[model samples]
Target chain A: MKIRPLDDRVLVQPLEEIESKTSSGIIIPDTAKEKPRIGVVIAVGTDEDLREKVKEGDKILFAKYGGEEVEIDGKEYRIISRSDILAVIED
Target chain B: MKIRPLDDRVLVQPLEEIESKTSSGIIIPDTAKEKPRIGVVIAVGTDEDLREKVKEGDKILFAKYGGEEVEIDGKEYRIISRSDILAVIED
Candidate 1:
């Protein structure tokens, strides 16, 4: 099952968080939590200017809480509007 | 502390979820969790077209997961690209 966004929205597959911790080395138990921050651009919207700005296969840093969640092929993806994108990752 | 997003991004303040559950009536433990879904548009972006599309004080539904997190006025807000907005709430 393929998912596509309408207008300037995009479909993103979020990256899984590492089981290990970063700075404090505090293992984040399921209790203490925040939103997910990293993701991959799966599908681009139909806006031309936006299309020029971003493309598919771009690994982007999106807002941890930006798009709507939809299940496709048992995988979770976000259907977000164009305005919510922050920056496109270059690495 | 005021935070404004750059470019086509908007500063969004996410709404808090209710303590109760939705359909299943199952209390979502602090462990089994997901990201936030609703937010209010705070600051509009710099892009002229995007600004025209969305505005300040708009209650919007964004992707369940989208932008970067910032602390402002001791509150957490998401700075997301305009593309992450799904629909603008009129009510």
Candidate 2:
């Protein structure tokens, strides 16, 4: 299932969170764990200017609590506007 | 204390989360809560082009799971790249 962002929004699939315990070997129970804040860009918006600014596969760093929450195909994703973007990762 | 961002990085102070229980009044324990994702722009980067792209006071929506986490004066913030920004709020 392909997701498309409207206007200047971008669809992102978050990177998986660490399922194991932390470096200290303290197993984090489900309640104490923080949701993962890393993700991959799935699709960009229709804005020509935004399209010129970013691409589909660019890796980026963004706010952990930004964007609107969305679930697709039993998976979770976010729809964030282009202005919320922080940086484009080169790699 | 004032913070400045380098290059295209943006310094954002996240908005406080609901300290009280959720609407359901379930009294969500801290262990089961998620980190706050909403933030206010503390500072914009030094890139002139990027500076023009964004401003210091603009409210933005971004990826919930993005940016590098940093601590300042015992407070936590994130330094996200510009590309992670999703939208600029007009209001």
Q: Which candidate has the highest DockQ of all?
A: 2
Q: Write the per-residue lDDT of candidate 1 for residues A1-91, one digit (tens) a residue.
A: 5666778898988766652123112222333245435567898988777787778987655655687998788888888776566655444
RMSD of each: 12.2, 12.6
Q: lDDT tens digits, residues B1-91, model 1?
A: 2333447788787776652234223333565355335677888765789899898888776765666665433466777777788778665
Off-target runs (Cα >4 Å) in candidate 2 are A19-36, B1-91
TM-score of 1: 0.45
Model 1 residue runs over 4 Å out of place are: A19-36, B1-91
Which 10 successive residues of model 1 chain A have the least lDDT summed? A19-28
lDDT of each: 0.64, 0.62
Q: In model 2, what is the error at residue A53, expressed in angstroms? A: 2.0
Q: Among these predicted structures, which one has the highest lDDT?
A: 1
> What lDDT tens digits, residue by residue, belong to model 2 across residues A1-91?
6787888888877655442122112122233133224456889999877777677876554556778999988898889876566555443
